[model samples]
Target chain A: MKYITHSLVILLSFLIWAGTAHAVEKTSGQSRLPVTESMVNQKFIFIGNLIKRSKTFKNIEAHGDEDVFEDIANVKALYKKAELSVQQGDYEVANNLLNEIVKLVTSITRKESKVTNDQTNSLRYYNERKATIIALMKTFDEITTNEQTANESLEPRRRMVDDFLNQAKSNITNGEVDGAIVNVDKAYDVAIRITIEVRDGITLIRELNFETAKDEYLYEIDRNDSHYFLLDITVKEKKPSAKMLLSIQKLREESDGMRADADNEAKSGNYEAATDILNKSTKNLIRAIRMGGNFIPG
Target chain B: MKSGYWLFILTICLSGSGIAASFAQEYDILHPPLGTEGIYDPENPGIEYLQQPSEALSLLPSSPTGNYVDWVKAMDDSLIEPRASIYGDQIMRAISMDVIMQQTGSMPYVRFPHYDHSLILSCTNCHTAIFLPKKDANPVNMYTILKGEFCGVCHGKVSFPLTDCFRCHSSVRDKRVLDE
Candidate 1:
């Protein structure tokens, strides 16, 4: 009878242990199922939508208006990595990557705030300076009747200066002080250079016309024409002196050489170089006119 | 409400002209055509550029000589009385209070005043939508502001921009408070 009691007691203890173990196992299994389902269903769907949004953003990035955003490559990489991470069940890492992408997108698309009272002042200053430069160019235009010389010589540089000034003003308004300063400096440098060149060209042309009687001779040199024609009607009665003719011939030779070089540069799509050469050519012709000293035949 | 009405008009004009509202809204602090005359003379030291079409000619110089706070106070004193008739009972507050911000170590303490804004805006415009009612709850930073969060929502869009540090960080004291 005692042996029977010991066996029953051992069986009861075994049953209790097995029941408790089964209960604990069921509890853990049930908890795990919900977590897995939640993660797979909710997070995966959410991540899927995020991925779609990112894909559209990527397409826009590929064909966007400008290459303003530098970190587009990094964003693409992060997006692909985020997808992989989500697939690998690393939601934490995927979430972080998504957040990073969001921040980057915001920064790229966002219009930066305008800051600094000085920006307004600087823009005004640049505009005022630009106006002055333009006025100077106009003055040069008025002094030089040669439209080609006046326009070709300084217009491109003037445009560049204007563009730089406008860009600087924009940078200032956008609070990019360093960029603004650089642009402003460039604008100032270009303006100063152009101003000097324009002034010199105008002065030389004026002096040449006053001394050479070139304008009074009714001489208009066509750039395309091989020959330089000086209408002899004005000096028909008074033939040019031998010394003046020799000076004119030498000046004509120098001018022709420059014109040839300028044509070559222009053919090579170096208009700026051509402009420079023509500017020199124009100045040389003016100088020749000055050297001739109003020669007329008696 | 008057500012809002003006903003609406501006928005309509901009939309009609096919110009971006943001582009129209963001104007230079010192507008050109600086002189009283039609000429855009930037060198003019007169207060012509400072005059808003809505306000009478200000006695203050274009570039005021006093401290920012004093200048602002003087502007308030001069204009507030005349504006009272126009505002009638619409003015939100009679006195000004400053919300001293010193949390961030990188910035000078910002003394945000209620005087200028309260005249135009009500409490509900910012209290719950942008900022918490309680003090020390909002963590204002340059990055977030640049992102158009917190003060940026109104500032960069409608109000005075966040570019001028002295505009907000006007306190004379140099107390630094570390972020918790």
Candidate 2:
């Protein structure tokens, strides 16, 4: 009993330490998306919580709907797969799988609204999954942004970027959102590689092209301001959570700052830098719209 | 017949209002056909049958369930069964059964016709999965059904709204009425 107690204390202490470390690192922003041991541990705890919540939802057991049962089984399998991926240190795959599980669980809950006797338990489960998905998305966003920044100084892998971008676009058109995301991630990875074999970098013609693209974005930002206002009104009317509203606000501010930076850089004849800033700003805006604009009707 | 004239008037009115009463009749491949009710609202007076009671059936004094029963009897079994399968298997074995719910006073008893559903869905769709094969095993209520737990799973999202009470609760307990 003494040995067991001691072991428990040690484990608890380690978890607390990890949590503290993760919080500190996040605030510090040492690396935009440093996938720490704590994040993986948190995921494991969430998975455990989900299992407990599923048990509380006795409908899955009491009811005999094959589709419902199949869905539950699929979620469980996904959770296991995510855990395995985490163990193998494949954080991206793990996170993607976790995202899938989150989407599936949330969608199921949405379809079968208030069916569970324990509404509180079901809600908690849904909220926890949503929170985890947000964390994963944030981490990926930061990683992509930071890595893209680093890759800017390298020789432009234009061909690779074009190919990946095309593939991503096609995937999106085909309604393969996950597949599109994966392709975009790959494109970013390829585009950012600072190769040792440096040829002539930042030609004048390329600079002119980037400047043109930057100007187009500036026009877009101005045009989209009206859309943003419309979205804000709609979102407010819908009475979204304070947290969602806050996220939208933060993204808008970030986009504004990036736009300003891009404008200044372009004026100073550093088109490449300006373009990069503009690109980041555009991405931030897109992410903002995607997250909050789900309520907006077509 | 007067019914034929009413049908023509209804068609003209619906077309004039620019509501696709015919277009919506096209069975959604995404959500399987469960049946619909022709809602009569004085505020919006128009023939409102989205996917149930058949496009052929007109809005008459008869209950939507009665219309559904008549439609099911006349409908080709192969048309609704062969193409659509929301739960995997396309070849669904039809089972005919009725769940007679005991309701008091003006509240009509629920006559759950498995025959109509089985035309599109298999026995495994609800049996032992959503509902047990035994009678009165599942404690079903309007509140729970509205929450998409039991019948509401298919009804509101794909089929039709539960606002039309007579659609499902069309069973008459009176011996003479039931015999007719």
- Choose the strongest candidate by TM-score: 2
Residue-level lDDT of model 2, residues A192-277, one tens digit each, is 23221121121111011224755554544443443454345446544567898798779889888987887788788776687667
DockQ of 2: 0.01
lDDT of 1 by residue, B12-123 (tens): 4544443232223223233322343366454533333254322222333242211112334555566434343364743333225456665322235566765565556544
- Each model's TM-score? 0.24, 0.25
Q: What stretches of model 1 exceed 4 Å from their correct place?
A: A1-298, B1-30, B34-74, B80-91, B172-180
Which digits, one per residue and each the tens of the lDDT, describe model 1 over residues A23-105? 45433442222234344435546544654566655555665544534566666787788778777887777767766877775
In model 2, the runs with Cα more than 4 Å from the true position are A1-298, B1-90, B176-180
Clashing pairs in 2: A64-B128, A64-B129, A65-B129, A65-B130, B36-B52
Query: lDDT tens digits, residues B75-170, model 2?
Result: 453222244456753344344445566521224667777657866663335644466443335656554565577887887566644544566767
Name the 10 consecutive residues with the lowest summed lDDT in model 1 chain A.
A201-210
Q: What is the lDDT of residue A211 in candidate 2?
A: 41
Q: What is the lDDT of residue A206 in candidate 1?
A: 8
Q: For model 1, what TM-score is found for chain B?
A: 0.52
